[model samples]
Target: MEKSVSKKAEQTLKKARVKYPIGVKLVVIITVLLLVSLGTITFLVSAMVSSDVRITAEDNNFTVNRRSATEAENKLNTVRSNVFLLLDMLNAAGSSAALSRQASAFFFERNQDIAAVVIPGSLELVNTRFFVSNEIETTLITLFLQNEAAAVRRAVAGEPLLINAAPVFGVPVIAMLYPWQESGYEQAVVTFFSSEDLTESFGSGANSSFMVNDQGDVLVHADYNLVRAGANMANTPIVQAMQESGDRNLQLLYTDQEGNRFFSAFRKISIGDAAVITSIEYNIVFEGIAATTRRNIFLTAAVLFAAILFIWFFSKTISSPVRVLAAAAGQIEQGNFEINLKAKTQDELGLLTDSFVNMSRGLAERERLKDTFGRFINKDIAEKAMKGELTLGGETKHVTIFFSDIRSFTAISEKLEPHEIVGFLNDYMTRMVRCVNDTNGVVDKFIGDAVMAVWGAPISAGSPMADALNCVRSALMMRAALLEFNEGRGGEKKPIIKIGCGINTGDVVAGQIGSSERMEYTVIGDAVNLASRTEALNKPLGTDILITENTYNLIKDYLIVEEMPSVTVKGKEKPVRMFAVVNIPDANDIPGAGAKGPRTLAEVRNLLGIKAPDMNKVDTDAEEQKYKIQES
Candidate 1:
């Protein structure tokens, strides 16, 4: 299933590719790449800017909240000083009236914001005149009496105690104890100040300031409802950041339960184990950064648009010439070698265009010459010649020469018109040449009614035995090919054809052997002459294929042949043994497959339609061990 989907996608892409011209495709590809690169850069820059803006805002908020907390601490210290002074007066006078007057002066006149002044352990409040509500006065008096030991411990330790026990029935205030121990009396001078004093220390804006006790309960809040409800914020992000930050101050960005983002700072108030928290909504805090980012995105988009436009035009300049060259190449592939392209500029693309034109012209000329050369020589040889390997020279090398001629060609031509004779000859020669060419034999030339080929001069079959066997195989296939050709002719009007092939393996001087202006690559040696003679002798021997004794020796183990009468033709002083090949039997089908012994050649004569010769007169014993044939 995956493979099918992938293949379908590939096909769709291929179709889409075909719909666009090279220039358009190039422009699209270049533009897309540029856009991706610029987009990535912009995104990274925006992210970095946003991060820096957040960090800077957090630091400023931390500073602001810290200052406010310090101010609140200073106010609490001032209240402590006033209470200490009142305690000194009470210890000096040791009278209830003096204590009452001192408390009244301190709470009502000296510091009107002081909510209450209490003398703990005396079970009497020194003064509650400043208490706006009776419940506040009663709550403070009760709390001080119950926690007298804690206040005394603070006095002994020289540290003031701050309690946010309750702001006296919803009236927020900070209470502090000044322990008094004068030899016999042990009491704490408790002072209460309104919580609004601390909350008002932080100036108002989009931000809200609040105070939370050690238990995370709201002690004083700009939002009064929170103070009334005593909301716990220990699990809030601001409190979590405060706990995690080992320092007394922390600033961080957090999101609330409603998913509104905020930037908050927390500072431990100097008066007690309370923290002052300032929180501002994220949108308000990062308004300027958001505006800047918007402008940056607009600028980035404009730059990217300009870049893509430039890339598109630039790519067109490059791909335009390439498109023309590609079209010219397509024409060339279809054999239309006439290309007319002009260079438009003096750049690499222009140079490439010029080079392509020259190359195409050169190829067209080469192809013309190649076709003409192929008509005179083999196609493979023509190719090698064009590559400069077919130089004017000669070299002596061992080769297997093959010669095949139609028997009774004159009689056959007399039976048809000149055109029919030409057609018939062409058809015959075409088939014969194919056999030779397929077996790696180079067809050297064609006589009036025969073809001469060789296997080891221009190129070799890599070994002498291979060349000889290839020559024999080509001969056998040519005979089989004739039967196929006759079968294709509808049988009635087709002229029956018979060809005789002769093969010989020997050394020959092979190379170009004519004037420089008109040279022909041909062989001139006794072997070439002998192979022709052997072909002629095929008529007298009544055989379709005959090989000299030397060729026979090389292919004896692979072919089944019968010895023929040894003959001495022109230019040879001794008779050369020849053989008529009958068939190539599968070695596994032959009896005594691995045995090495001399076998009489007559054993295969019946299969080849040749009469057995008298064995005693033929020197059959001399044909054993390894066969050798002289020039004939």
Candidate 2:
């Protein structure tokens, strides 16, 4: 028994010579896919959030700068217009000096930011001027006239000069003066007021606002100390951008001198040489987004870690069962069919493990039976039985039946020794059986030197038409295989042989026949009987193959055949038509061959060394009475 098992093992290994290289497993593939999916999602979300925050910051900067600039310009315009109104009131000549004094007091009351307003007399009184403030009018006017000499000269020379800042006043002061000469005398009005309110309503909270002169001097700023110091901001990015830009307003991102980045905006203001600048730090702008991104990254990392761990453990559940099954299969290969596997979970892996256990037990029983009875069953029947698919009784099937016999087996057997005859029959049966198996037909049995086969019963080759085609194809294959088998043969021990095949297509009952203890899988019906009778006619007709009317009808277009006289069977009243097989046109798709056979019966008889029967002898009635041949 051990020797038998070992020999079987060696045979199985020899048959399983083909091997393929292993590839990457599911765990790694799934892990890589998961990482890519999470990473892509995280990156896209972070990018969108960052973009939105940056845009919002820029918009805020632009809005703050524009609003603040408008407020400052409105304030300055109000102050300048009020000063002009005072000049106009003073220039009204029909009014008395008392009226002019009263009008100046009213102007000073209405324009409280005006520090002191000076109105020059007409050309007759060039040295004479009216004062809007009684207390500091003379001192402030003298200081501004002395400190800003160029400005004073410009105002007197008929040029309206506006000075936003006068350092001599030691306050936020806006000084404006204009020429008022009706006669050609050097006379003008000068007024000074605080610029404190210009920026009072601008900068607050995270956004800071400031104004820079064309020279880049910090004129009005949220920081009072910077304004007082007259900070030079010529090199600042916002200041430089404002000076260079042709736009009325602009916004961008920049890093300040301190290397702190900000979202900043610049707006050109109406105030002399000044523009409003608003800025908010980049960190403050996108801090929320940054924080969110950090959280997302952390979460993604956690999810990735968890997914990897899960995939690792999950793959174990599958691979472990597979490994156990593989080990069990190795034992089975060594003829040890006993298996012990306990499925732990309720997943597919568990189901597979359970199925494997059942399969091992079933294989063990089959092994025991085989040891008792030997390799005793047909291959097809054994396979179906092992798979628990075989059942007793029979089924009605549309099938193609085939029968083949050696031309002169009895006379050859008489000449040869018993052992030699057995050897010869075995060789011939092996080749013929291969043709049947190759065409997917089941060999029903071998009787003496004759073989019977069936297609479309154990399993149909799709339909009756297909079975008929395969049946004819198998006969053609036998023709080729026989010629090859007889390549170098002759004399008594190795006689050159000829075979005749008959095919018929019709309904039959096909199944495992006889009692369960001693059974055979075969087909039985009139189709099988007709096929046997047809094969017997081949020798007398000088044909190598023949088919009944039923099969000829099925594959008439595919085969090149000649019609023969109809035959009268024992039971049938009608004469059944028969045809002699010649050649199948281009039978490609058959393994190792095609319709490379005799195209004419003369060639077939010549190849097989058979003389054609003389049809003019007139023995049709006698042939019918003796061999069931009839001319229709």
TM-score of each model, paired residue for residue = 0.45, 0.55
- Which residue pairs clash within candidate 2? none
Per-residue error for 94 in candidate 1, Å, reads: 42
Give candidate 1 misplaced runs (Cα > 4 Å): 1-313, 339-355, 384-388, 414-420, 487-495, 552-558, 563-577, 584-632
Instruction: Please tell me which predicted candidate would have the highest TM-score against the true structure.
Output: 2
lDDT of 2 at 449: 93
The whole-model C-alpha lDDT of candidate 1 against the native structure comes to: 0.72
Give one digit per residue, the lDDT tens place, for model 2 in 58-135: 887788888888887787678778877766777784458888777777876677777776654332111122233322
Per-residue lDDT of candidate 1, residues 1-632 (tens digit): 99999999999665444233545656676677667766766675666567777777777777778777777767777877776776666666666786656555654577777766666546344335555444444555575446556655664455656666453446666667655666776556667667776666664766677777665777777766666665778899888777667788877778999999988988886555677888878997779877767776777787778777877787787778889989999999998788999978655676677778989999899899999989989887788878978778889989999998887778777767888878888888888898898889999999989899999878888899988988887886776687676665633246666677888989999988888788888887999888988887665566778899988888799887777778766667778888987655543322222133114444433323345433444332233412223322
Candidate closest to the true structure, highest lDDT: 2
lDDT of each: 0.72, 0.75
